[model samples]
Target: MADKEATVYVVDLGASMGDCHNGRDESDLDFGMRYVWDKISTTVAASRKTWTLGFVGLNTDETNNTQDEEGLEGYHNISTLQEIGPMTMTELRELHPKVKPCEAYSGDALSAIVVAITMIEEFTKKLKFKRRIILVTNGESPIDDEDDSITDVAEKLNEHNIELVIIGVDFDDPEYGFKEEDKSRAKRQNEETLRKLVEACENGVFGTMQQAVEELSIPRIKPVRPFKAYDGPLTLGDPNKYESAISINVERYFKTKRATPPSATTVVVNPDRGYTQSQAFDDGDVEMGGTEFSNVKHMRKYKVNDPSAPGGKLDVPYEELAKGYLYGRTVVPFSDSDMAITKYETTKSFTIIGFIPFDSYSPFLNMGETGLIAAKKFDEKSEIGLSALIHALHELESYAVARYVQKDGAQVQILLLKPNPGIEDEYECLYDVPLPFAEDVRSYQFPPLDKVLTVSGNVLKEHRLLPNQDLKEAMSDFVDAMDLSGFDVDEDGNPVDYAPIDEVYNPVIHRLNQAIRTRAVHPDGEIGPPPEILLRFSKPPEKLIKKARPDIEALIDAAELKKVPEKAKGRFKEAVKPLSGLDIDAILGQKKRTVISPENAIPEFKQALATAEDDETVEKAVKQMGEIIRKLITNSFADVFYPRAAENLRVLREELIGLDLPLLYNKFLRALKKSLLSGELNGDRREMWFKYIIGGQLGLVTKEESEMSDVTEEDAKAFVKK
Candidate 1:
C-alpha cells in the first residue's frame, strides 16, 4: 500500500545453505520459512495495490567456485525494489531463486556486514523524510563461543548509524542430519546481536525475512523508502498503485518571507536625559560613558517613577523588563564622539545608541562568576590572554580601592564618589589633628613621648635660670614642667598644676592593627579578612612585593623565570641618538607663544615706523606688525591674569600645538582669515607692513616663508613660473 514502508535485505549464507536444513525436516524448514514469510507478506502487502518488493540471496562461498554459464545457471534470481505512491502498487517478483550453501570456511562477517551497511547508510544518510534499512545474513555464523568475535563486528555495524535488519537462516536442524546446535545457536545469536547495530541507527530492525518484510510493509504516517530490492512473485496483489509522491514548492513558500527592521516608533528613553532641567543643572548634568551608560538604563527601568499612582510613567515597576532578559545584559556605553554611524549598520543594522534596552546589567560586571566558571571548566586561566588579564586586573583594582565606612555600628556609606557623572571619583579619609593636641603624634606617649620628653629636657636645661622671666618664659616653663605629669615649678620653687590626668585611649591605631592581624590567616586553613587590610598598613615597598608574590610564584612554577629581564638603562639611552638638524629647544618650544619684540614695545613700534616709507613697504611693515600682534595676543592669552590661569593656558597651548594646526587651518579656518584680512591697506597697520618688508630684506624669514618651503619642488616651480 502507499502507506507502507519498504524493508529489504540481501542474505549471504556462505556455502552451507545447500547442505543443511536447519537440522530439521525439509517440510519443517519450509514451514518455518513460509510461516515468517506469509506473516510479513500479509501485513506488508495489506492493500496489495502499491506494495514494493526487493530480494537477493547469495551463498558466497558456495558460488566462489561455480561459474555462471548462462543467465540463471548458478546465480540466484533477484528482484528490484520500486518506489510506490500513497495509493498504488506495482507487479514485481523474485522467481526460481537458488541457494547453494557451502561447507565450513573462513568466517568474515566483518567484511560482509561492512559492505551491506555502507550501501544502506549511504542511501539513507540524506533522506530525512524517509527511513531505510538492509538485512544481510548467513544463518551459520562463524563466531567463536569464547572470543565474542561476532559481537565485535556487530558493534562496528552499529556505528554506521543507519537503520539495519538481520536475517539468519541456519540449516543445522536434527532432521537435516546437521547435529551441531552451534550453527543454529550462532545464527540465532547473530540475528539477535544486531540490536545494538539497529539501536545505533535511527531506523533498524532484526528478524526473519518474512517477518522483516511484513514489518516494512506496514503503513507509517511518514513512510520510509526501502533499503534494497523486494523479493516476491509477480501478482495482482502488488501495492505500488497506492503510492504517491509528496513534494513541496520551496521557492514559492520562501518568497513570501519579509526582512524586518526595528520599529521606528520605539522611543528608548535615555536615563540620563530623563532628569529634569533643574536636577541636571544642579547635579552638573550626569554625563555617562562606557558600561555606566547601560547600567543607568537598567537602574532606571527597575525604578518606579510613581509606584503609588493609578497610571503614571512607572506605575508598573521597571524590574519586569529584567525578568526575561537577564542573560541579554550585554550593553555597554560609548562616548557620543566615539560613536560612528557605520557601527550601527551591521548584520542586524542596530541603533548603537538608541533602543538601549531599558533594563540590563553589564556582563563585564559579572566577570567574577564568569571568570571562575570559565577558569574551572575550560582551563581559561591558562588560556586567557594578556588583554583579558588586563581587563580583569582593572576591574579588581577598582573594587580593591573602594572603601566602605560603617558609622555608629549601624549606618553604612560608600566613601568613594564619582569624580563627575562622566568621570570616576573616589573618596578617602583624611587625618585632622586638633590644634591643641596635634603635637602628640602617638598614643599615650611611649616612643613619641620619649622623644618629646628628651626635647623638653634640652629646652629646660637651655633656659635653666629663667624662673622670673616674662609670659614667654613662663610658657616655656610650663612646657618644661612636663615630666610624665602635669606639673610646673612656680617662681617660689614649688610645684603647680593646671590640668587633671586621665587614662588615654588609642582606638584608631588598635583597630588598624587588629584589621591587619585578621588578614594574615591562610584561606586553606581558615577564611580570613581580605589581604587589602594588611596591604594598607604595610607601606609602599612591602605592599608591592606582596602584590606581585602570586605572579612570581606562578612564573617559577611554569619555569618562565627567564621572561623577566634585568633592565640596561645606560644601554637603552646609548641606543638612542639625537636626529640631525633637529633643535631640541625649538621643537619643544613650538607650542610656546614667544613675544616677537621682547624690549619696550613702543620703542619697537617706533623703529618699525622709521623703516616704512612707501605703500609696499608699509604693507610689509603692517604684515610684520600683524604677525607680532597675533603672537602677542597668543602670549597674553597664554599668560592670563592669574598665575594658575596662565599655567592652565600653557597646558592648553601645548595640547593645541599637539594637533596639526596647518591641516586644521587649511580645512576649517583659512577662509575665515582671508575674509578678515581683505580690503585696502591705508591705516597704521599699513605702516607696520612696511617694517616687515624691511625686516624681510634684512633676512628675517617669516612663518609664511617656512610654509612655502614645505611645498614640493614641482609645485613650487609651477607656482613661481605661473
Candidate 2:
C-alpha cells in the first residue's frame, strides 16, 4: 500500500498578480500557476485515492472558507475552490476557471495559509498522512501579519507535521539568483512576512517561483509498491512422496520491468453532451473548451458474399463463426468439442528441474521481466530453509532451473534462479528471470570475420574484409580510451561508476509522462524539449572522446577509412555502369530515371516501358514500378497509399497483358504476396491483398484472360487463396 498524502495549493489571484512581472510575457498569475498545475496534475495522474489535493484562491471575488463563515476579519475575498479529497481530471477541470484573478485584491496571503492548514488538520484528524501546504504568489498583496499571528499558523503547521512551501514571483532569492529590480515597498513587506512564517516552521521551503518552475523539468521517478506475483511452496521434488524432498514457501515479486507510456483512449466528438467553458492560454494557444467528447463505439458485423442478398453480402450471426488454427497455409476449424484435444493443460506448480553452474548460464538467454523469489516473511522455518538453500547454491556458484505454472491450465515457463544471500537473521532470496525454450531461441550462422573464403573455397587471411594487426590494435586502444566504467566521481571525491543501471532512467517513459502531465493542464501548450537529465547519456563524455582522439586518428589511418556517401536506394540505383565509369543508358541514347516520385510514378513507369528498347530496359521499368509500390505501402500513414499502389498494379497488369508478358506480372504478384504477409512492408497488409488485389481481379493472369499466359485458371485462383 502507498502512503497517504494531503496537499493544499494556495494560489494568490490578486488584481496586482494579473499583470505581467519580471519582464515575462505572461501574467504573474499564469506564471505561478504553471508550478501549481504541474504538481496538481501529477497527483491527478497518479489517481491514488490516498493522494488528495485542495485548492484555495486568494483575492478571489467571493469568500467561502471556514474562517469567513465564522466572521473572520482577514479572510475576505478568499475562497476554497476545492476541498481536500481525491483529485481527478474532472476535479482539475472544475478548479481551472475558479482560480482566475479577480479585480478585488483585499485578501491576505497569511489568511489563505491558515485556511489551508485548518482544512488539512480537520480532514486528516487521527489519520497518518503526509500533509503539505504550497503557497504561490507574486508577493504583491499586503499581509496583515500583526493581527493574523504568523507564529500561531507556523506552530499549527509543525504540530500537524505539515510541510509549507512559499514561492514568490520575482522575489529576491540569492540561491536562485533572481530579484525584481525596483521592487515595491508593499511587496517587500509581504515577502519578508512570508519568509518569516516559513522560517518559524520545522519543515518549510521558501524560494522564488522561477526556481520552483525550473525544478519542474526534472522528472521525478515514481516508486511503485511491489505486488506478489506468486505465493506458494517452491519444491525440489514432491514432498508427499519422499520425506527427503525439500519444500520452501516463497513469494515472487517483480524486481525490474519495462515501463510503458499510457495508451490513449479512442474518443469522438458528440455535440449533444454538456461541456465546460474553459480556456487556459499559453504561448497564444487557447484550449478552446466546451468541445464535448465521448468514447468511440465499435460495431462489428460478419458477412459472406452472396449474390442473392440485396447488398451482395449476407450478414452472418457472430455466434455462428468458429475459431480456427492455422495449419500450413490453411485455417483448420476449431470447434468447442475439439478444443480440449489440443490444449496442454497444466496445474499451478513451481518446482526445480535441475541445477547448473552459474558460469554455464548466459545472460543472453534471459527473456523477460526479472523477479525476486523471497521466502515468506514471519515464517522462521521457511526463512531458515530458504537461507540454507541460498547459501549452499552461492557456495557452489550454481543456479537452479525451475518450471513454473502460475495457475491451472496456464502455460508453463522456464525460470533461471540465482541465489541472493542477506545479512544474518534477514530473509534470503533468489533472483529469477524467464529463460527461453529451445524452440524460442533462434540461431543464425554468419560468415567468419577472421578470414574470407574465395569462390574456389580457399581461405584468405590478408583480405580487406578482415582487420589487420595495426587496425585491430588501434581499434582496441580507441575502445579502451572511451570506456565509462569509472568516468564519474562521487560527492565524496571517490571514483564511482558512470551511468549506473539504477541511475539511468528510461527516457521514453519519463518523457511521455512529463508531456502527458504538462498537456493535461495546458492542453494546447507546447511541451518544452527533453529534460537535460534525460539527455545526459545521449552522447559519450566529451573529455573521453578528446582523450581517444589520437587512437581514433590512428585507426582511421591504419584502416584507410573514408566517409562513404549514402548510395541511391531502391531498384532504380541498379543502373548499369561500365568499367570506364560511363552511364550505360547515356551511351545507349536512352533517358534513364534515377528515381520515381509518388505523384507521377505510374505515368513515368508507363513512359519508361513504352520507350523500353530491349528486355533489360523493360526489366528496369518493372523494377522501378515495384519499388514505387513497396514505398507506397511502407510510407503510408494508414491505408491512404494502398489505393494508389493498387492503381499502379492495375495499370501494370494491363501493360503486361498488352505486351503478352504474363511472367512479369505473375512474378511480381508472387513476391508482393510474400512481402505483404511476411510483414516486410510494415504490417499485416492481408486486407490490401484481399480488397485491392484478389477482389479487384489483380491476381495471377490465367490463359482465359491472356492466351500468351501459361497459368491454369485453377492454379491462378488457388495462388490468391490467402
**Residues 429-543, model 2: lDDT tens digits:** 8999999988998899999989998999999999877898998899899888888876778899788889877668778888999888878887777988888888988998788
* Whole-model alpha-carbon lDDT for candidate 1: 0.33
Deviation from native of the Cα of residue 57 in model 2, angstroms: 1.2
Question: Per-residue CA lDDT of candidate 1, range 19-137, in tens?
Answer: 43544454322333333343333433344433333333434443321123233332322222222222111121122123233343444444344434444454445443233345445
Write out the backbone clash pairs for model 2. none
Per-structure clash totals for the candidates: 72, 0
Best by TM-score: 2
Tell me each candidate's RMSD, in Å, in order: 42.3, 11.0
Give the lowest summed-lDDT range of ten residues in model 1.
Answer: 247-256
lDDT of each structure? 0.33, 0.85
Off by over 4 Å in 2: 145-148, 171-189, 276-290, 304-315, 326-331, 423-427, 455-457, 486-495, 541-550, 565-722
So what's the TM-score on candidate 2? Answer: 0.76
